[model samples]
Target: MSGGVVTRGRERRDQQNGQNSKTIEQKRDEEQVQHAEANSLALTMRSGLEAISKEIRDLKTEMKKDLTTLKEQVTEDVKSEINDLKREMYQQLSANTKTLQAQGSRIAEAEGRIAETETWNMEVKDALCKSLKQQQMLQDKLTDIEGRSRRNNIRIFGIPEDKEGDSAPKYLHQLLTTELSLPPNVNLQIQRAHRALAQKPNINSPPRSMIVHFLEFTVKEMVLKKAWQKKIVVEGRPLIFDHDYATEVVQKRKAYNGIKKLLKEKGIRFQTPLTKMRIPGTTDRSSTDPHKKQHAMPWQRVGERREGTARSAKEKLQEFERITQDSE
Candidate 1:
């Protein structure tokens, strides 16, 4: 029984040792499993961090590229706008300069025209003065010729019209002798006799005036002086004699009506036949003849100057050429 008891206790002791060894082995296997799980978790965390970091880097790169592209585009647009503005300014300045040049040229042309007009006016004035002086000289010559032509003519007025049976000169001589009651032997030489070259209505009408031409101017003066002294009447008609004058001389004589009236009122005897006022007895006479009513006679000078006639187109061109040569 003792041997068996000892052996049973030994067997119990061996079984306890085996069970402890199995438990130890199982604990060791559990520890190894936990360690493997921890290692796997750490590997997973590291891989996730790496993936996040790569994503961040990719985003930063994309943003940088986008910013660079934007900057380039903006710079190009600004450059284009600046170039356009510069070109527009240059074109506007050029146009303004051209316009100013055109206006300046027009102003210069107008000034030249004004200067030419003033010069032309002065030249025209000078030409007119020369023409007037030449005309005055011509008029003086005509007046001198007129005075010499009327030196010998005599006019007989209020003579009876006659259809003469004989020569007109002989009949007039006989009439003058008979009317003057001259001596029967008086020899009255007559040159020519005729009525005025005017129309006569009838033979019985108041007779037309007669004009007689004497052989000598002295004889005519003698006859005129005799007629002035004697009141010669034929029947109931009275005859008169005067100096034969031209129509212009007669008109000039009409202007002396005031002087004649004054002379008559003062009982002064004056001769009308002479061109100058001639007093038979007195020598003092005025040179300012009443018959001369013109402001500027042929003998008188014009005191005031007048603007001359405008030059003809041809003359103006010639003058312009002369002025241009002088200036050059």
Candidate 2:
């Protein structure tokens, strides 16, 4: 019995051992399967990592190439734009230089024209002066000639209008002979007698003066002297006689009216020869004569008594032109 029991026990122990060993084997198998799966997963993960790294490297290479090409293109475009700008600036500078040169040339031409105009103006001024001098000389000679023509004429004032009738010379001769109390046999020799060339005056106005031409200058002088010596009356009016001087001479003589009145007040005797005022018994040199001492009395030209020297016709003309311009 003990042996059988021991044998069963050994068998049992063997079975337990076998079952344990089978279990251990199963566990080992399971471990081996898990290790194999783990190995496979690890291998797959390594392969995927390697693929992702390769793709990243390839992408980096392509990006570098693209960046290089873009850099080159941008550099080329910048250089081309700079070249275009330089060319445009050069064109603008050239145009400005040409414009300045043209302006300079025009300025030079204008200066030359102005200089020529100035020279022409000077010549014109000189010519005008010469012409004025010649005109003044001719005018003086004409005045002298006009004065000589009236040397044998007398102007009578305070005469009634149309009193001389149709035959003026015949009527004036008889009137002067009776009024002046001249010799009946003596011929007054009145060549022509007429009223002044003016419109007839009204009755209230003074009558126009009568101009009488005598055959001889001496006869005219005699009539003037007698008329000045005594007052002559015809009918109801007093008459006056004077020399028929030229208009210019009369204007010049009128300028001496103030001086003549002053001289008369001072009881100074003076003679007027043409336009000169000569004080009797006074032998004084003219004011224009620098070598002699200037005196207040003697001979003084009318309109020049208070002036230094006579103005040239050119100067007078210039003054007249200035006055006319101012008036305008």
Residue 202, candidate 1: Cα error in Å is: 7.8
Question: How much is 212 displaced in model 2, in angstroms?
Answer: 1.0
Write down the lDDT that model 2 would get: 0.81
Q: What are the TM-scores, per candidate, against the unseen true structure?
A: 0.45, 0.58
lDDT for each residue of candidate 2 in 80-138, tens digit (9 for 90 to 100): 99999999998998998898899899999999999976654544445454455579778
Model 2: residue 245 alpha-carbon error in angstroms = 2.2
Please estimate how well model 1 matches the true structure, expressed as its whole-model Cα lDDT. Answer: 0.72
Candidate 2 least-lDDT 10 residues? 300-309
lDDT for 179 (candidate 1): 66
Tens digit of per-residue lDDT, candidate 1, span 1-328: 9999999999999999999999899999988888888888888888888888888888888888988998998999999989898899889989988998998898899889889776665555555545666666665556556644544556777666664335777877787677666678865556667777889758667777776777777767777777778887765778887877666566777877889999999999887654557778786554445564556544433565434433553388688799999999
Q: Local distance difference test, per candidate?
A: 0.72, 0.81
Q: Candidate 1 versus the native: TM-score?
A: 0.45
